[model samples]
Target: MTMRQHAVSDDFLRPDSINAFTDALRGAKYNVDAVLERLGEAGQEGLTRNQTMPALDRLGDATDAQADLIRLFPLQQIVPRSRLAAFLDVPALIEAGVLGAIGREGIHADIDVRPYGFTDAAGEWSGWVAADPIPGMDSIVTRTRPNYVLGVSPASTSLAQLTVPDRVGSALDLGAGCGVQSLHLARHADTVTLTDINPRALDMARLTLALNGLDLDVRAGSFYEPVAHDSFDLIVTNPPYVMSPPTDAADRLVYREGGFAGDGLVRHVVREGASHLA
Candidate 1:
């Protein structure tokens, strides 16, 4: 089978693979800079600070240039394309050499085929594509739909940062999402249970925890159903608190809607959580 076929068979879009891709793109950014500098030496007006700075930003991930490079290059040429781009930005990163071969049978094949595109408010060219996945993250929610609980939101990070560490017996992470809070709690707790109604989110939580080298108990069930009653020393939940009507009830997925109106889920979790706590 062809490399593309092999990649498709394997799901290579894991977090690590994304990181590698991003690193290569960063290398490309340096190459681009050198070219711009040479252009300045030749009195070709060089890249304007404004034009050039954005290209540097584009090297990170999911930008127009990265996407275009992915689409333009042959399958076998991806790593080299990435390296060439990297060499353009930072010559030092390319000293070890560009990738000569990509393992066809990898888990993140779809990421290679998927195109990353972006548009600004005035619809100007945002010439950048993500060459790597965000560390510890898989997919980002780009669309705002009703019943869609925002994942990795600032609020979740805030709560995670504010969490008080304790040498607890057990902890429960309700609506774990990406498992950020659960992973945080794992530092101090003996065991952490990450629960989420969305299986996809749960999968990501598992990956995130494992990536961090923490062995966590990942369960998929509606809030509180997966755990034994009164089993946890502490329970932390960032429930679906959006007050808007769901775009589709089936799409509620428990991440956005609490199934109760107006902080009902939060209140229920608070009330029920008291019972679940040891």
Candidate 2:
């Protein structure tokens, strides 16, 4: 098969495959702390700044399975098949579109699967979040596509920290990007509904849930549309609040640009979202 010529599809989401992937990741110790441990203090600092070279340097000589995973994922570097297959389901991940084959002996991740862990009233939680290949991590794209689903950002981290920890019957993540906020809600809410307008974002959200060995409702449509008749005890939104100049071009990212002028999108989300809460 032409492994390098890949087209990401829903075929890679097989439940059994995803379960195996999750197992491999945990077995490889791929988590928030793994990155810090692999890339010492200085390397961690550089990675935090989006400067991957330092961390990449730290992993240059490391040949363990975990190190190979760190390179294939976090550093976006290609890894030898034999090494990664030691801990990961290479064929399953490749079929799922999570990992793509490069040359005969090398493989690389097609998306950014980040280790996301946070502390809340529910307790300590750790999960994997998937999104489009980061531009900086991959040499393929100079800019992001319109539907580019961003991974974790300062906004998501901050919003996660500020969320109410009380348990609820049902929860809604209004503008679920890669479902980061939804992961948090799932901890406290009996059921969590993730809704997004972008198609790719919806796919990433599902992948994020699957990687964490969790599942919840993930729908597509503008805010409140997917859950029109549904009501939730708690509702949270980590929306696109960039408030950039109005533009309908392909350069406008769906994850951050609300496509409305000024604060109009924010107002719309807040005003319309209030009605969906129980």
Candidate 3:
């Protein structure tokens, strides 16, 4: 297994380029419902298993805008520059750090771009999330990265659904990896603060927010230190709960395994949550 760190430039956050990228995504029907509908049960299951062949088979050889986007994003399959250029601003994608170009025709994504959405009492939340592709995904080819930021996970969806969507004055996403929780919170909170220990996660979260046309206060600190001096009307977190036993740094993953042991991290959050909650 080969391990690699995720890298992308801040230029990806340029408003005009991001707008064009998102517009193309919407025009291609790259949303939760459409992508899943196209993938079917087998393909969906394959994705869950970190297997791409089934989904690739389902997608077939179609180079249509949506299929190409699907292939490029979630599937982690590289697309030929010419194919993507059919619908996307290819040069802008390269310049925006969405894809790499060595003056070559192959376009590859170092990170993952996923379409996420949920409807709440406030309104509809539909947008893309940009995060480091979780390590060990496509398990055969990838290994863990020390500070990998997770995109949307099963827990992410459940948490989003579980959180009460009532409007609030301010909210904090305590461990906002890729800002998934913030996407939901931003709609209801007049202000949202995202804090994470890993700087990479903070970057990914910021990228996620920028892509979604939402901006929030992002700070770097483990747990609550960044917001220790402040409180909010609502505080939300989907923390690392893998409960892994002690291991070397090689075995630790920031998104799942915190420096704390077992559920200590979770316990600390629960124990200290009230003090920060308004």
Candidate 4:
């Protein structure tokens, strides 16, 4: 059987290419501390609420590589080709499917990439995450795109922090959007498998893990279907738990809605997710 390729094909999936992409990002100083320092106090605070304008304003006219990447990504601003090339090799990133040229406006991020950092008993870990943009507060009502894969958020951090720091032989991150939980699980588990119903989520998860020089088994399936009749030493997931009345909303966001009735998805995970856990 042939497997479906996710996002930009598998041409750029090689370790050498992934490592090059990682090097470029590292050279530009894309990290949590750098981003916070660039955004200043107000902008940093604004980001917690999904606001980026303040950070954008602070980054005004800054052609520095880090600034250029920030504008192109988390801020979702298009930047000039020359400026973007100053910090990043536009051609290489384009080949890696990380950057795309948008007409004469120069370059923009093909994916949402941002620095994520956290502390555990093992000390602190920091890395970049990639995913589709979250519906910003001002734009939520106008969002019309369904299947929007989510980037890093408070919930991801909370779950990572709350998790027990136990070593395990294998781990499964269900609904592994952008693979943040799976990334954490890699540090403790001998093997990690990331599964998601959304194909784009799986694609982004694969890229997210690769960008960090980590490898895991990525599968496309709803919940435990991908691992049928199998179990793991650990299972971690923050399934869609939103509680709201159904509406004919144009944007049928998969990241926020689990297709089941309100909160029912959460219940289903609670009831059935254990079957996949060792």
Q: Which candidate ranks first by TM-score, i.e. highest? A: 2
Model 1 lDDT tens row, 104-158: 4211211211121222232322112111122212123354333232335557767
Per-candidate RMSD, Å: 12.4, 2.7, 3.8, 3.2
Better of 2 and 3 by lDDT: 3
TM-score of candidate 2 versus the correct structure, residues matched by position: 0.91
Better of 1 and 2 by TM-score: 2
Q: Write the per-residue lDDT of candidate 4 for residues 135-221, one digit (tens) a residue.
A: 564354655357677887789989987777699998989899889998789888999989998888888888888778887899999
Q: For all candidates, what are the clash counts?
A: 31, 1, 0, 0
| Candidate 2: tens digits of C-alpha lDDT, residues 1-278 | 43433234455566777777788778888888876788898777876765778888888788887787788887788889988878877887777678889888889888888788988776788878898867764234476677888898888988888888887899998889788998888888999989999877888888888777677988889888999999889888878777774486566777777778888988998788779879
- Quantify how close model 2 is to the true structure by its C-alpha RMSD in Å: 2.7
The candidate 3 region of ten consecutive residues with least summed lDDT is 1-10
lDDT of 3 by residue, 38-115 (tens): 998999999888888899999997888889888887887778998888889987666555677645778877668888
Per-model TM-score, in order, reads 0.53, 0.91, 0.90, 0.89
Model 2, residue 159: C-alpha shift (Å): 0.7
Q: Give the candidates in order of TM-score, highest first.
A: 2, 3, 4, 1
Pairs in steric clash, model 3: none
